[model samples]
Target: MKLSQLGEFGLIKNARDIFKSLNENIVVGIGDDCAAIKLRKGFLLIATTDALVEGIHFKLDYIQPYQLGIKSININLSDIAAMGGIPLHALLSIAVPPNISVNFMDDFFKGVKDGAKRFKVSIIGGNVSSSKNEFSINMAILGEVKKKYMLLRKGAKAGDKIFVTGYLGDSAAGLEILKRSQKSEVRSQKKRKLIKRHLMPIPRLEEGRFLAVKKLATSMTDISDGLASDIRRICEESDVGANIFTKNIPISKELKDFTSSQLKTRGTHPADGSSKLITSLNFALYGGEDYELLFTAKPENVKKLKELWKNVNIPITMIGEITKKGINLVNIDGKAIPLTKEGYNHFKG
Candidate 1:
C-alpha cells in the first residue's frame, strides 16, 4: 500500500506492532521516540539504525563513496547522539550494485573504518551483498546511557523553549547543486554552502554526550527530516504544542550570501518579494539529512545550556516554544501562519 494511504503515524502504528521485544534488556520498545532497554551496569542500551540508498538518500554524483560510507555510519551515530547516549559500537551492512568495483567496496569500508575511528566506535559484524539498481549502506548503532540520562522525544512540557544546533538548509543547498550540475555558470554562494552542507553533515556526537551528561535536554530528536517534521514528532510524542519565532531561526551567513547571489543572477524573486528566499530556508527547515540535534528545555535551563556548551560548533537558538495544542509558526509581525512542510519523505519525491 502507498505510504500516503497509511500515513506516517498510521504506518508506524501498524508496523510497530510487529516489533516484538528482541532483547531481554528492552524495557520500552519501538513506540516511544527512543527505544529503552534495561541494562546490566546502570546503563540503558539505546540502539538506532538508519540506511542510505544511492538515489533515495544520496546520489553518487554529489558525494564520494568514501564520504557516503562515512555518512551512512555517522548518521546513525547522530541518532544515538540525539538520545544523549555514548556511542560504543556499530554494525555495518552494505549492498553494492554489481557495477560497483571491489576496490570501491574497499574504499567504502575504509571510510566506515575511518568514521568508527573518529567516533571512537568499534565495528562488530555486518553483511555485504550485491544490488541491482543502487549501492546502500545501513549502520546499526549500539550506545549506552545512564538510565536517568536517556533523552526522550516525548518529554517536552508546555512553556519549554525549542532549540536547534547549528545553521539549517545547507543540505538542501547541496541537493540543489546536485540538481543543477551546470557548474560552468555562475552559482550563488548560498548554493555552494548548501552543497557543502549536504556533503558533510557534522554529527553532534560530542554535543549529544555533553547534553546527556549535563542533563540539559527535556526531549530531543535529530533534524533528519528537517526541523518541521522532527519537531512535529517530538510534539506528537509529548502530546504538547510548540511555538518558535521565525525570527529566532539562525540562518547561516554563508547560506544567505549564496542564495542571494542565485536569486539576483537568476532574476528569481520570492513570491512575496524577498521572502521567496524562504525556499532555501524552508529546505533547511524541512529537508532531511541535516542531522543536527533539536530538543526542548525549560526556560530556566536556557542560561545554563548556553553557558555549558558555549564553545560548540554554532549557537543554539530558541526558534519557538512548546505549546499546549498544535505546531504553530508565527511571522515576524506576530501573525499566525502555517508552515508548509517542504522536507523530504522516503516514498514521496
Candidate 2:
C-alpha cells in the first residue's frame, strides 16, 4: 500500500513498533513529545546531525533501501568517531514521497535497526513527513566521551606527523565505476569491492577511540570530504601548514590495478600511465566519503602508534608532516607543488 493510504499517524505507529528501545537509559521513547535519557555524569555529550537527500546525496536506482538506511546511520556515527565519542542514541527524521510503498519503508527502517544494533545504539524517536518529490533522511546522533579523551581538529601542531587509516581513492573510484557501469559491461571482484566501499563504508570507530584513549592523535578528522579538503580543514583549524608526499600517500592495490586496467583498455602506453595515474590519484585526494581517519601525531608517538596499530588490524600510513605554514604536495623527487583543489563542494557546481 502507498504511504498516502496509511497516513502519517499509522506510519508512525509502525515505526514505533520497529524501533523499540534497547537502551535502558531512555526513560521516554517514541510516542512522547520528547525523548528523555539519563546522561552519564562523568562524560561529555557530543551530538551530530547529518542529512542525505535523494538526487543530491544519493540515487535510489543504484542503492537499496536497506543499504540507504545503513549508510545514513554510518555517516552520522562517523561524526561521533571523529570526535572519539561512543554513540549512544539517535533520532531519525525522514521526508519521503507519499507514492512510496509501505514495504519500501519497512526495508528502510530495517536497515536503520540493523545499523543501530551493530553499533549498540538506541533509536529513541524520530519524525516522518511527506515529501512532494524526493526522499531525504536527517539523523541526529548523541554520543559521549571522557573529557580527557575528546579530540578536536585544532590540536595539531606545526611539527606533528600526518597519518591516515586504511586505503584512499577506492570509494571515489567505486563511484566512478558505478556511474560508468550503466554504459560499460565490466565486472570484476575488484570492481565489486570498490562499489561496496562506496555503498557500505566502515566508520573507523575503534581506531578513533584508540587514538583518543591512548592520546595518540594530536588532531583528527574523518575523511568524509576527501583527504585534500579534510586535511585542509585540519590545517585551517590548527593554524598550520602541511607537506604531503605523493609517494607516501597510500593507495590500495585494488585501486591501482583498476586504474591500470582502465588505462590499458583505452590503449594508453605504459610510459603515458603516469598522467592516467595522476587522474586516478585525484580521486584519492579529492573524492569524498572514504570515511577513514586523517590524523596528526607527535613524531615521538609514531613508534608507539605503529606498535599499537599492529594489534588493531587497521592499516595506517604516515603520509606527510605538518609544515610551518602552507599546503604543498611534494613529489618523489622532492619538488613541492602547491595544492590547488579542495574536495567535493555541494554548492560549487
Candidate 3:
C-alpha cells in the first residue's frame, strides 16, 4: 500500500511498533512528544546529526531501503565512535514522497532497528513527513564517554604518528565501478567487496574505544571525507602540519587488481603505468566514505599501541607523522607534493 493511504499517524504507528524500546534509561520513548533518557553518571554526552538525500547522497536504483536504513545509522554511530563514546539513543527523521510504499518503509525501519540493536542503542523518537519528489533521512545520535577517555581533533602534536584502521579506497573504487556498471549486475567477488565497502562501511568503534580507553590516541576522527580532506581538519584543529608517505598508505588487494585490469584493458605499457598508480592513489587519497578511524599518537607510544592492537580484527597502519608546518605527500620518488582537499564537499559545484 502507498504511504498516502496510510496517513501520517498510521505511518508513525508503524515506526513506533518497530522501534519500541525496553531500556530503563528511556523514561519516554517513541509514542511520546519527546524521548527522555537518563544519562549515565560521570560521563559526558556526545551528540551528532547527519542527513542523506536522494540523488545527492544516493540513488534508488543503487541502494535498497534496508541498506539505506543501516547506512543512515552507521554514519551517525561513526561520529560517536570518533569521540570514544558509546551510542545510547537515536532520533530518526525521514521525508519521502507520498507514493512511497508502506512495505518499503517497513524494510527500512527493520534495517534501522537491526543496526541500532547491534550497538545496543534505542530508537527513542523520530519524525516522518511527506516530500515532493525526493527521499531524505536524518538521524541524531546521543552517546556518552568519560571525560578522561574522550578524544578530539585538536590534541595532535608535531612528530605524533598518524594511523588508520583497515584498508582505504575500496569504497571509492566500488562507487566508481557501480556508476560504470549501471543496471548490469556485478558478479566478481573483488567488485562485490568493493561495492559493499561503498554501501555498508564498518565504523571502527572497537578500535576507537580501545585507543581512547588506553589513553593512546592524541587526536582522532573518522575518515568520512577522504584522507586529503580530513587530514586538513586535524591540521586545522591541532595547529600542526602532516607528512604522508605515498608508499605507506594502505591499499586493498582488490583495488590494486581493479586498477591493474583497467590499465591492461586499455593496452597501457608497464612503463606508462603512472596513470594506473595515480588512479588507485587518487581513490585512496580523495575518495570519501571509508568510515575508518584516522588518529594520531605520540611517537613514544607507537610500540605499545602496536603491541596492544592485536586484540582487534582490524589492522592498524601508520601512514604519516604530524609535522611542524605544511601538509604534503612524500611520493615514491621522494618528492614532496602539497596535498589538496579534494574529497566530497556537499556545497562543491
By TM-score: ranked, best first: 3, 2, 1
Off by over 4 Å in 2: 183-186, 264-278
Instruction: Give one digit per residue, the lDDT tens place, for model 3 in 1-349.
Output: 9999999999999999999888999998988789889987899999999999999778888888999898999999999999998899999999989999999999999989989999998999989989999999999999999999999999999999999989988887887777767676746999999989988777777788999999999999999989898899999999999999999999999999987787634321111112344367878888878999999999999999999988889998999999998999999998999997667777762
lDDT of 2 by residue, 1-349 (tens): 9999999998999889999876789999999889999999999999999999999778987888998989999999998999999999999999989999999999999999999899999999989899999999999999999989999998999889999999998887777777656734767898889888898898888889999999999999999988888999999999999999999888888889888777634321111112243355776787778999999999999999999889988799999999879999999899999986567777763
Q: Using lDDT, give the best candidate's number.
A: 3
lDDT of 1 by residue, 1-349 (tens): 4332444354334324322324455555555554554446878778888888787777786677677777778888889889888876666666666565545555666677677778777665555565767877788988889878889898999999999888777676576557757646676565666776787677898888788778898999998877877888899999998776788877777766656657634422211112244355565666667888899989999999999877776668779999898787887899876665445566554
lDDT of each: 0.72, 0.87, 0.88
Estimate the lDDT of model 1: 0.72
The C-alpha TM-scores of every prediction are 0.81, 0.94, 0.95
Native-vs-model 3 lDDT? 0.88
Clashing pairs in 2: none
Which is the winner by lDDT between candidate 1 and candidate 3?
3
TM value for model 1: 0.81
Candidate 1 residue runs with Cα over 4 Å from true position: 1-40, 182-193, 264-278
Which candidate ranks first by TM-score, i.e. highest? 3
2 or 3, which is superior by lDDT? 3
Q: Number of clashing pairs, model 3?
A: 0
